[model samples]
Target chain A: MIAADLAPGAVLSLECPTITRTALALYAGASGDHNPVHIDIDACRAVGIDDVFAHGMLSMAYLGRLLTDSFPQQSVRSFEVRFTAITPVNASPTCHATVTDVEDGHAHLDLSVQLPDGTETLRGRAVVSLP
Target chain B: MPVDRSIIGSRTPAFSTVAERGRLRFFAQATGQTDPVYTDVAAAAEAGHPDLPVPPTFLFCLEMDNPARGSFLSDLGIDVRTILHGGQSFRYHAPAYAGETLTFWTEVADVQSKKGGALELIVRDTHVERDGAEIATLTGTIVVRDPRAGR
Candidate 1:
């Protein structure tokens, strides 16, 4: 598995536009988490935000996509992440991942999500088990 | 007096967890996934999948009892709502296709104190199989924290 071959400090980053509405709709539909802060722009702005925000899981799913794509040969055995900040919608968001450690058949990665303004939106880690 | 760390090693019993088809469809629809592999069995085979397959996150819908249910953590004075999603990990030996009954077992691995608050790590694992063939195993972590005390 490529996960077994990754060296510590290996990093991957991607910058992409944020589809806030689509993501919130998707997560709300998928997880049944229909919180207004994700979909209601007016509601979001009521609390001093520019626009609606993406669901934490949507950003997490992007990390999931990263793990599955990076080590296609390996089945992800474990993953963990913390939502540091809100991911704003209708804007661009950059996502990155770095290999932090590999031991006992597990590859650990430090991940982050950022906005164009250089705001750090999320930070977390994911571990994959090698085949 | 400090709590006993011995309870961390307790294991939960394996049991049959229901996978509701309608809910799976709803979840798939919500995610904007339209693949026939997830909605139709025959189409899944036509697409080369063994059976109808749900998305990776589908496992969360199944509410299984903790092996240490009503014990340990809560007994030690932990609040469930203060807990947040730590992360999820899954291993697929084979695709867990739809229409198949799946069984899973879980256990608590460890718990430790973090600088800001107590981070209670509970590992809930599920091993899925069909007709004696192992299909997948998922290990998920739920991090319980005292949100009121954290930074």
Candidate 2:
């Protein structure tokens, strides 16, 4: 979609599947970030965390999905996120983005990932160029 | 154990890796990115990309290819068990695609203490390039808790 065609406050959303232990393990292998806190429940307990949690990058990846699914990858000029909270196992998360501004063929979006209860796990923004 | 601020300017040797198609596909699937441009070259071409485009944030994963990836923490006397991913950011100058050999260079950007020295934060910036042309910059912050602080 062209930036000029996007309206300010236009929001796009994606419902992510429930995070599972198997998925975490898969991400561990795929991303080569074998942080035990994301895959080993026993290790998580030892570290004073309640249970194995999703990788913050995983949440960022979900937000990336929201952008790539909408704009072509090449059009994405910048994407960034800050990990705000832990996404617990089995948490059903969703990604949302609102078109905040469009200027000179560039569209800016405010993005976030949150649990069903509205607990935000990640917050971010992206700038995309319209083709 | 407090992190020594002296290592803030340290840099790791540069490394390079080819963005293999299979690996890109696996990452897209793992991240639940259903975009075909990330997994199919033809689809990517149809979408105005030269080839399967590397998804954002995936560069952070590629930066891990550095042979000394784990040495930074060990050299700082940090235990891997006590660390958490604090934050991450990326700036893209150009799109990276599958089959491209991308080089990465990383340097420790900053260090700080929180909670009366119980938690230490280390920030690093990685530069990515293809054939000497800049592709992206990855910024990451890792937080480590001193076990001696006893929570």
Question: Evaluated with DockQ, which candidate comes out highest?
Answer: 2
Which segments of model 2 are wrong by more than 4 Å?
B146-151
Clashing pairs in 1: B12-B67, B52-B98
The model with the greatest lDDT is 2
lDDT of 2: 0.85
lDDT of 1 by residue, A75-97 (tens): 56555566666566676676788
Quality of candidate 1 docking, DockQ: 0.21
Q: Which stretch of 10 consecutive residues in model 1 chain B shows the poorest summed lDDT? A: B61-70
What would the per-residue lDDT of candidate 2 be over residues B50-148, giving only the tens digit for each residue?
A: 888888888988887677888877877777778878889888998888889999999999999988877889999998989898889888999897433
- Per-residue lDDT tens digits for candidate 2, residues A1-131, read 55555999999999998889988988888887887888998976775766888888988888888887788767888888878887998898999999999889889999999998989999888998887
lDDT of model number 1: 0.61
- Give the Å error, residue B44, model 2: 2.4
Task: Single out the weakest 10-residue window by summed lDDT for candidate 2 chain B.
Answer: B142-151
Instruction: Candidate 2: count the clashes.
Output: 0
